[model samples]
Target: MDEPLVRWDWIARNWDNGSPLAIRTLLENHVVMAFAPVLFGLLLALPIGLACARWRLLYQPATAVMNIVYAMPSLALFSILLSVTGLTQTTVIIPLTLFSLAVLIPAVVDGMTSVPDHVRQSAVAMGFRPLRRLLQVELPIATPVVLAGVRVATVASISLVSVGALIGQGGLGALFTDGWQRQFYTPIIVGIALIVLLAVGADLVLIALQRLLTPWSRARRSA
Candidate 1:
């Protein structure tokens, strides 16, 4: 505890001007590294997920493949990518993108499927074209469930980005390696604590966003 305090103090003292390892830079890096992949993955998976929802045949196979990829060890995944992408951020981002896609795809499917059958029938009765209904009706109705999946992806991305430190690109994870190398406990503890805080903070922010966007969901809850 005291050690972490000392580290935090050191971090604060250097906060304003700590070159590459500045706490601010690290925090920003952590957020960027973690979120970039998730955003990319989510975008990629949204259509894929929707397709699966439409075509049941694609659903199970896609889920199975993603699950297999997700089951692979993170380090092994990184190492394998390293062989091709080398030490660039691409190595880190690609794996994480796949991971985020795995988490988001099922959630997207769930969200889409959760739109009650009656809702779809009503949309069809109202002359809502397929595209418009999907864009306006389905997406809005599915927002809460989709957001829940996004929360999972976000948290997983944040936690896994630390593993990048192994390949010299870990954001907040770099501090952990540095601390261990120097036999210091502060950076390690601080890194872990901050990572958890970051994950929780992001999750809470997403939850708030979900509430703000889905007024109908709140209305339903109140009723």
Candidate 2:
């Protein structure tokens, strides 16, 4: 019987002998699976969120639907979607995308709504049309908040994508399930650590992006 490798030894060995699928390959696959859904969901949520922000009438209904969808278990949701999407990336992506909407939409609504009323008034007084104002002024001001939500949704999506391992669509999650079945702790522990690190790294990237995109907000706070 092979002896269980210590965590440090496992890392060193992987550098030479390599881990399953090559750690780099697994990492890349993980990124693809995790971020794709987030991007898709954010795109879908943006217009709906903006509409909700503009019209108070849409908020309650939007909130109700998002809440209901968010409440569904990720695995169960994937299972239900499997028949139609059928054991493909679509099954995984669709459910994860829907999950992301629960986070992204509220972020959009809150960020847009939180813009100061005076800001909107100034835009109107400046002869900015509604669409122009939303594109130029409002979204820029709301960017920091929306990005914060994106950061959260990205992290959550990465974690949930692991749940797809049972369906053969798991990226790094395959490591966890394989390790568990074989009683090998190295891959299981390594997979867990990598996922967490990915989440933190993604979050920091978004923070930097927010700062870069919202220079006026930073300048104001600095002043």
Candidate 3:
């Protein structure tokens, strides 16, 4: 029998009861695997970035290592982790989290550094301790830039999380691979479309969120 040319009509029909299970499965896997690791990276990267920016020695080696991790191909990173952990969720999460560090760290450092030195001096003059200055003053001013970093990291993680399917983590990428094995294109096309949709949707949401979080940014925007 000739292969069916996968089209929107075929996709629309399958999207009903036929593929709802697959969609849900993929979405659940995508959300858990993507968010957990990416969030971990952001949490780690932000503090480290702040510390390094405050103390330059830490920035050199930390930035260098993060850049190395960022440069690593996802497949290569997965293969290395798979050798150590053997095809499990760790193989996905560990590498994805590490991969997010480059974007996250730079974002954090930039945000913290963007706090004018005069502001830092004023906070010191007011007797705010170092940590207090950072928490109450610097970070508040830098929230938008830091959130933008998170936006970038999360978007990147969402796109790359599909690679987890290679280790049986079962994301939308799993559907894409499954379609490839079965010689069906619908699942592959649909999976890619869903990923694109998720990325664009998440970016918009994050942008709105950043705006909401940093009200001072609005004045700057208008100025």
Candidate 4:
């Protein structure tokens, strides 16, 4: 006999199985694994990006290095990290953070460079120090582009977290492996739905954040 495409009973049984494989547990794990690298990468990218923006000479080399890191396969990187971190979340996070940097650094540099020359001159004329101008003027103006990069990095990270299952830390990715091993369809379907939902939901939140942070951009567009 052929099996049905989904089994609601299986989903009910495992929804809160009280084990690591439980849906709730994996969902929580997925959220943490997906978001942590983006947060860390953003924090790290800000200063590096600022430096790259200030020193145009550094931008090419920095981006080149980041592109190389980004080109590395996630599974291969995970294997290499295994010997050091031992099947841990750190192995997954480190690579994702590097990947996030590749996308974010360029975004940040472009965003910073996008600042209008006249606007910067006005800030200087207003007696704003370099640091003060960067914080109060340039950064706010750069928010839209930087947030766009963040959205991309975040969604990519969320998708990549599933690959960690091979190393036993894939969060919701475990469901994929489990479904494959057992030839069960429920977990696989559930996992994919959850991942897609997470990506879309996160993107919406970031868009809202961008609007809130850069009301002037909207006003300019509306004009």
Candidate 5:
């Protein structure tokens, strides 16, 4: 007899099995693996992006390096990282961080450049120092664009983290490999559902944050 597409019993059994293989554990791992890189990338990208925007000469070379890093195959990068980090989560995080930088650096540069020259001049006229202007004026104006890039990087990272399952470091991605090996559909379906849920939930939260932080942008759009 053929098996049904999903096994409720299997889900119930593993939902909180108190093991690393449990669904809840995998979900937690997935969230950490997916989000940590974006956070780190943003922090790093801010300075790099600022430099690139401030000195347009650096933008081309920086972007070229990032693009090359992004184009490298994830599996190849994982294999290379394994020698240093072993089968640890760091192996996954390092490469994903690089990929996040690839997306985020450009976003940061664009957002910074989007600040109008007049606005910058006005800041100078208002006795704002360079650092103060960046923090209090330019960055606020650039929030919407930067957050847009963050949204893309976040969703992409969530989906890409599953690829790490090939090396036993994948979060929810382990479910995919497990189900495939066992010929069971339950874990695979559950993983997909959870990943989708996570991505959508994250995206909605970011959209809400963007609205909250950049009310003027929203109001301008509505008008």
Candidate 6:
């Protein structure tokens, strides 16, 4: 592989230098197609996985589907869906969401399972209803672990959105394709660097959010 040529000056210029229209379009598309699916997957999977953990019968089916989809290689998933969905943004969204579910389900399940039974028993003894108990007692204790899973999912989605570029769905991946096609290394390098920045930045933001949401965990850490 003749490594792509990276021109720092050129990359810096393009990093935030595109026409206003282009910059806005990229931001809009990224949020709608890329961010939405991952967030949707998390929302759907968290409840399902938590419920499944408490109810064994649901576990087999949910985990089975997640296992099968997660086992599919990213490239294969893309290729197969591209054939059916015809290389549109939906093709990218579907597979990435599936990938997110696989990761998130396990995380949520593990977090929920780790909650001490004594806590649940106490909640029940206090006459707390099932949903109320889960919301107030179980979920609070599991916050740190569940947020760790979300951190993993957010980073993974950021990287995978690069793959969305192949389908002509715009994002940082556009830079990589442009570089490869034109043999201009700057775009590729810039794309990778920005992607890294996005992931790291997201992780930091999530960590802060997790600390804010799980105040007890933060207090425990300081103790």
For candidate 1, write residues 92-197 as lDDT tens digits: 8999999999989999999999999999999999999999999999989988988999999999999999899899888889888988898887778778988999
For each candidate, what is the lDDT? 0.89, 0.85, 0.82, 0.94, 0.94, 0.79
1 or 3, which is superior by TM-score?
Answer: 1
lDDT of 2 at 181: 92
Residue 149 error for model 6, in Å? 0.6
| TM-scores of the models, in the order given | 0.92, 0.90, 0.88, 0.96, 0.97, 0.85
* Alpha-carbon deviation at 46 in model 3, angstroms: 2.1
User: Alpha-carbon error at 200 in model 1, in Å?
Assistant: 1.6
Model 5, 84-108: lDDT tens per residue? 9999888899899999999999999
Worst 10 residues of 6 by lDDT: 19-28
Question: Worst ten-residue run, lDDT, model 1?
Answer: 1-10
lDDT of candidate 4 over 3-114, digit per residue (tens): 8888899899999989989999999899999999999999999999999999999999999999999999998999898999999889999999999999999999989988
Per-residue CA lDDT of candidate 3, range 122-182, in tens?
A: 9999999978787889999988888888888889889998988877774788877888998
What are the runs in model 3 whose C-alpha is more than 4 Å off?
1-21, 218-220
Cα lDDT over the full model 1: 0.89
- Per-residue error for 12 in candidate 1, Å, reads 2.9
